[model samples]
Target: MLTERWRETLVDTYGTPPIGLVSGQGATLTDEKGNSYIDLLAGIAVNALGYGNEHVAQAVYHQAQNLVHTSNLFATQPVLDAGAKLIERVGDVNARVFFCNSGAEANEAAFKLARLTGRRRILAAKHGFHGRTMGSLALTGQPDKQNAFRPLPGGVEFYPFGDADYLRQLVELNPEDTAAIIFEPIQGETGVIPAPDGFMQKVNDLCEEYGILLIVDEVQTGVGRTGTFFAHEIEGVRPDVITMAKGLGAGVPIGATITRGRARDLFTPGTHGTTFGGNPVACAAANVVLDTVDAEFLAEVTRKGDYLRQKLENLPNVDHVRGRGLMLGVVLNAPVAKQAVRGGLEKGLILNAPKENVLRLTPPLIISQHELDTALNTLRTILEELA
Candidate 1:
């Protein structure tokens, strides 16, 4: 079986899956056993347009046929278009985009930019996840993920996720030494926790007052996942830097570390580069996703998110819902989220448990109301049985 083969050949970084998914369409997936599932995880919020997207496939196919890669030595039209589109969405003509392969790389670029400011100190949030890469891992405040890889790149200080007063105290401890303040608008890895209300505005104000750069990590919350082009946009706070991935390229791997104002000028040519970053094929796919997830499309996403949240909140075992838009976490009254995942899978649903009591739902941005209703009915049954 494929699972057996995976166990024998592959490293145990990610434990083998119980079953193999053969294919998918829209928000539904088919497993090797010929069973179908309503995909609510959406590849951890990567497939914004859902599976079997003809437009993304065609864009990738045509771009691959013409030019797949040219490294950083040459420019590609798709790369330029993707960057311009991101900047346009950011509404900052001065913002510059640095493309990379995944969310980790994006945060690494942001880390490097902070270092370039000549101040060694950086502030991050506890229980917040950025990525697993070395620099990003250091920025991530979760000790469990960092303990294994001890003695990570230092100079990062972590404050509790939504404690603005503590954050302010940390900044005042040595404001001159602080280069940047980095955080996720919504913390997804630790059960989809969001920053407290007024936090974004506070972060922006601190950065402005202290001459520090504000870096917002939107890797899991961007690309219309939060019913906004960027989650931080809702607070009307424009950070000096924003990093995003996941849904940026549909299923294609693409990460962007975007910078505005002076922060945009930090990397001068040889300072940073990626071989496969912004490849035409990936950029072309991103272009399709960007064009498809416009204002109108995102409005629909908002409506669906509210609908799903209402259903989840009313579930028998559900405690509440956290995060926002399509990037939601259903908090259960019991710590049986792992078991709930198994139940969901057995009942033709693909669910994710980021915490013992939380089920993270980041379905495709294009998932329809009918799909949501069907999935909710199944989920209700699963929760009832568990209860």
Candidate 2:
């Protein structure tokens, strides 16, 4: 009944609802039909603390009872606390935060910030996905998404991701008019592709050389997903603008664009705004997520990610694995990822295929070692059956 209702009421965008989840706790989910599955996707990495976390739930409950939203017209404690926490996490002395409601909005804010630099052109990495909105969509390099919506806010170009030489050439070619160079430290949707060695530093060098703003989209890789609070932290690169959303609020719906140095002053009053941005309840939830993801827990995430990757490397039909920390992509020898996903579901394990031959895994940060072992064993069984 829920599936039928979804088909009738919802747009035909996601094809179909795979299952109606009734409840979740930690790394596990239960469907309406009483089937339980180990959730490896974690709501596409937004469920950082996993489902039914008492701390997050309490935060949301208390905040909602007190205040949910006040728009940007008035100041609220939750929003202020959330912003301060974000600034603290960024560790940028001059950074200021703009809170929105999703990754797309965060990127949208970043795009507008770039435009304020008086340069029109924006360079992004090939196969990089920003969001589905118009501004962020224009910055996205995936042709399939852009082809339909032609004439989408021009002055955007694409360079090969992880190819520093190509990026240098492109930046050199459009030196004068290039406003910003936006990219994901690790491309998540096109499969988990991490930045090549020294590539991020090279990009930073080029951006500095050309006076172009460096915009790192950390929507999927931020907030302890990549073992660090931010993926670029590993590279020690200072970006002018950083967009983040997923895992920030631990599934409470929040987005943030952190701007530092001169970039922070680019937007003054009347330049930009949002109605539901920086919502109080969402900010309250985000504060808890930020407080919980400490240095020690992030270190454990790194260890677990290493363990999971090593286990997959020895699995059948897995050609290679890429990505950092818990964010991973399993590249298969054949185009059996969809089959593997189906088999995984049948075997009571939730997995996703972001690409035809690549399986993306972004389990909860609090996932146990036993759960990881179970997921690996289930994946091996699925791979053997597909092979």
Candidate 3:
């Protein structure tokens, strides 16, 4: 079996595979046994347009045929197009991009940029998830993840998320020397926790007053997953830097760090680079994602999310639903979220449990109404059975 094969051959970081996905179409995935399931997690929010996206397939094919890699020395049209698309969505006239291989790499780039500010301290939100690399891991506020990798890159501080007063106190300790504050607009990994209203505006003011770079980690919430091109756009604050990955390449491996104004100019030549950072194939897919998840598409995501949230609110075991767009966390009346995931799997639905009581649903942004209804019906059965 694929699970046994993985246990024999692969590292244990993710443990054994629960299911082996051979192919996918629309929001449905087929396992090794040819059993199909409605894919709700979307590879943990990576697949924006869902499976069998024709435009991405064609773009990737075309680019792969002509060119795939140019290292950091040369450039390809697809990579250039990808960069342009990111800036177009970022809406920052002076924004510059550094492409990498994953969300962690993008956060790594942001970490290095903070170091270039010549400051000793950086602040991040508690329970925020930013990649697992040494630098990004340090910026991550979770102690459980950091404890195993002792002596991580130092000088990072953690602040309670959404507590603007606590953040102000931390910054006021030595505002001039504070380099950057990295945070997620919505903490996706811990739970789909949105920043409190007006919190971002206060953070923006503090950053501006102290000349500290504002780094918004959009790794999970970017590329129209949250009904906007970027989740931070809802708060009306312009971050000096933004890191994105998950949905940008429509399931391909790609990470991007977009820097604006002064932060934009920090990465000079010989500073930071990657070999597979801007592969033409990956860029090609990104170009398609950017072109597709536009105004009309995003509007539909908003409507679909509202519908899903309302439906979940009336579900039997669901205490509440919190999130924007397709990124939702179903807080359960009981600590049966993990059981719900297993139940979903058994009943032809793919789901995730980021917390014991929180069932996270990050289905493909393009999942159809019929697909949603089917998944919800199955989920209703799952909850009732648990009850």
Candidate 4:
């Protein structure tokens, strides 16, 4: 059904959808043909409180009725309130917020901020994906994506991920030339690989020794996806800049660059801005999302993550499991991830395979135990058949 409609209307970007979803409520989606599915991807980790949540919907409605947009020239109450709440939630008084429309845009703003500090070279990790924008693309270490868009902004170097010694050597060799070191706490696109033990701390020390800004791109892992408000909190390292988007405003399009200490003042009045960056509707939705992902909700996320890991580990053909909190990866014995995803969809489950051998799971933070158990059952049946 999706193929017939998508072939005529939509572009050929994503190929074909497994099913035509009509509506969603909580962690489940309903198709046009009356089929229901357990949504484990959560719109690529964008739905913080799941679909059609009362608080988020109400916040969007009230803000829409009140004030929607006033441009960046004038200050609005909702934007200011959201910014204050972000600072408070992060527990960093010196941090400042720069709003944007998407994860790539947030990374673009952070890249500009790093450049403004009089540093030229940017150091990123291998297989790390920042964004598709020109500035952010330069920092993306994947060659397959970057080769097509040649003549991109240069002066970026890629180092082995989770290798502190190689990173230290690079920083020491180019201390004065390096501007910032940007990386993801967990490499989501590359199968949810977290930093090795003590590697993040070593990277932080290297950045300090080289006087380079450290930027953590938390677009996919932030906002309770990793059982924390911010994933970097688990490592106990405060980055100079943190870029977030996916789960910030639930389903609304919103992104932000939060800078700490002196890095917060890098941008002046005319340096960087966006027309709809801090719009009232998006900020209002983000405020609701933040309020919903409090201490108790985070505890539930940890509990669910542990349960999901144990269940997935016991499933047939699942060789290993990686990642923390609700963000997890099931490494299969063979490259049957695509087949498993297709099979799960047929069994009324929505999942994603970011890599050939790794199946990614980013269920909504509000997903109930019953819902998770249902998903687990569906996945187990599918994997058994595929194997």
* Model 1 score (lDDT): 0.93
RMSD for each of the candidates: 0.8, 0.9, 0.8, 1.1
lDDT of 4 at 92: 87
Candidate 4: tens digits of C-alpha lDDT, residues 1-387 = 766889899988788776787788989989989999999999999987898799999999998998889998889888888899889977888789998999999999988988898978888999999999998998898999999999888788999999899888888886898889888989999998998978888888888877889999999999989988898888788899999999999999999999886488999989988999999999999999877789998998999999999999999999999999999999999999999889988899988998989999998888888899999999999999988
Q: What is the C-alpha lDDT of each candidate?
A: 0.93, 0.92, 0.93, 0.90
TM-score of each: 0.99, 0.99, 0.99, 0.98
Residue 78 CA displacement from its true place in model 4, Å: 1.4
Residue lDDT tens for model 3, 333-382 = 99999999998889999999999999999999999999999999999999
**1-387 per-residue lDDT for model 1 (tens digits):** 778888999999999998888999999999888999999999999999999999999999998898889988888899999999999999988888999999999999999999999999999998889999999999999998999998999899989888888899999999999999999999999999888899999989999999999999999999999999899999999899999999999999999999997598999978998889998999999999989988899899999999899888999899899889999999999999999899988999999999999999999998978889999999999999989
lDDT of 3 at 10: 89
